[model samples]
Target: MKNKSIQIQEKHHKDLQKLSESLGQSYGKLVEKMILYFKRTGIDPDDLKNESPSHKIQQLDKRLVSFLKVQERDILKPLRQETYEYYQNYDKTLKDAKANINKNLGLLDNNSEIRANHILKELAKQRKALITLSEHLDPANKKGLKTVFQNIFKNAN
Candidate 1:
């Protein structure tokens, strides 16, 4: 005669298990051990790992990622790129600006007054975006986020 058993793992988060090698089994088998233990005993498997606020911090850290993404059309990216390229182009005006202001500058054709105005406008908008991003990365907000991330990425090493 033989008996059949039903395995039901409840109140478990699966990833919270901790074990070492030399247990003579793969990760799947370790998970099975957790499942078996939970099923046999009325214990929650998730009570093992550190489910710290680190998860929330990881989510919050990506908030500034979009700011970093800013494309060519992006106000900050274009402005910065245009400003850098403007001075990089070899020309008298840029050379003079570099000498006088100690910073290289680029000069567009005077004939394309409309294009010049558009470029200047875009540069201004980019400056605004940079300012906004800077403010957001201020110490106050960073401190709050740091507290949350301490669990995940603290300087332990």
Candidate 2:
């Protein structure tokens, strides 16, 4: 490839550098991507002749939104779905654990100490599993699940 250099104002250069870092791309790659985007959008470089800073920022924001939507569709949505399924499984496991503990409590008269120890052990295991699953969940789901587990533990005690 042929090398070319263009002089930009220091402020604009700094802004470009920041943009490159934010996008996790090298300066050259970022510029190439931007050029490709303009081409794909049928935007002529010359048409930006009188673009103000705010206008430029608005354009960048539009591109950012588009990028985020694509990311959500291509990546985040599937991951969230998987996480939701895992969360459901964990919730079912928690319910099963609670049911077993309750059944053991019902047999407390026959082997009270042994059954009590077993219930405590099962609760601890469930709590640990909940914590681990919560860590893997997205923020909103994590908060809800954590709250549920907290309530369950509080009630158990």
Candidate 3:
């Protein structure tokens, strides 16, 4: 391995030495590790001079929150409203259909009751006429068959 020297402030040199000893690494190894860290993270060393790490993290958190808010406003809020309106319209349509069906059923019930009553009256009249005809045709009747036939002919005239 070849050794190299670079000029730096005394304070920075002492700080680097203290950090190296605390980390249990040689001075050269510590510097190599620091270079590798910056390279892997793709961070500009000059950018760290203006802002602390905590400040950068806070900025990222704020950006993420704003992005979420925008998504909610642009996409989720409208979707939620549309879903609510669709359900409301569906509920109204269902209620209207149910009312129409109930009204039709009521009309059908009334019409059927009236028609059944009229049919029953017609059937009763027919039954009465059949009973009268059967009694006249009966052999046991005191009025003979000849008398019944003569009466039928007279009525026809």
Candidate 4:
């Protein structure tokens, strides 16, 4: 490559030098990285000169929203399905427990009360799990839902 030189204002040169040091890169590498970033983002640095900060922030927000929508469709959709399946399984287990308890209620054996109490406890636990799953599925609790779903899926595997 041929050697090239360009002159910039003293203040701009100092700013670039500081950025390079902070980024642990040489000034030439920093300039190249900036050029690559601009190209990858399809952004013209010159055009930014005429754009207001609010305009830039709006653009960033739009991009983030688009990314989140895609994530919801891809990641969150499967998580939601898994959560619903878990809830359904719990409901079926609760129903089975109740049916068993009813069928065994006629026994006068000492173990009958013990078995009834155990079933009651199991029912309570299942109810609590259902409530928690419902809360995580609520539309108003997206942030909490994401965290809960992540933990659920993480532990499942």
What is candidate 1's TM-score against the reference? 0.23
TM-score of 3: 0.58
- lDDT (0 to 1) per candidate: 0.60, 0.86, 0.84, 0.83
User: What would the per-residue lDDT of candidate 2 be over residues 12-63, giving only the tens digit for each residue?
Assistant: 8999999988999988888899989877877777785757669989999999
Q: Please report how far candidate 4 places residue 43 from its true position, in Å.
A: 12
Cα lDDT tens digits, model 1, 54-119, are 775776777656556754357877798888887677576767766876432334446578888899
Question: Where does the lowest 10-residue lDDT sum fall in candidate 4?
Answer: 145-154
Off by over 4 Å in 4: 1-50, 107-157
Candidate 3 weakest lDDT stretch, 10 residues: 145-154
Clashes of each: 2, 0, 0, 0
Tell me each candidate's TM-score. Answer: 0.23, 0.33, 0.58, 0.35
**Candidate 2: C-alpha RMSD after superposition:** 25.1
* lDDT tens per residue, model 3, 1-157: 8998778899999999999989999988998999998898777888846576699999999999999999999999999999999999999999999999999888786779999999989966865675567576775766565456547656755
- Which lDDT value does model 1 have at 37? 71
The runs of at least 3 residues in candidate 2 whose Cα sits more than 4 Å from the true structure, single-residue gaps closed, are 1-57, 108-157
Candidates 3 and 4 compared: the better one by TM-score is 3
On residues 55-127, what C-alpha lDDT tens digit does candidate 4 reach at each position? 9899999999999999999999999999999999999999999989888775568788799999989966875
Highest lDDT: give the candidate number: 2
Q: How accurate is candidate 4 locally (lDDT)?
A: 0.83
Q: For residue 99, give model 3's deviation from the true position in Å.
A: 1.0
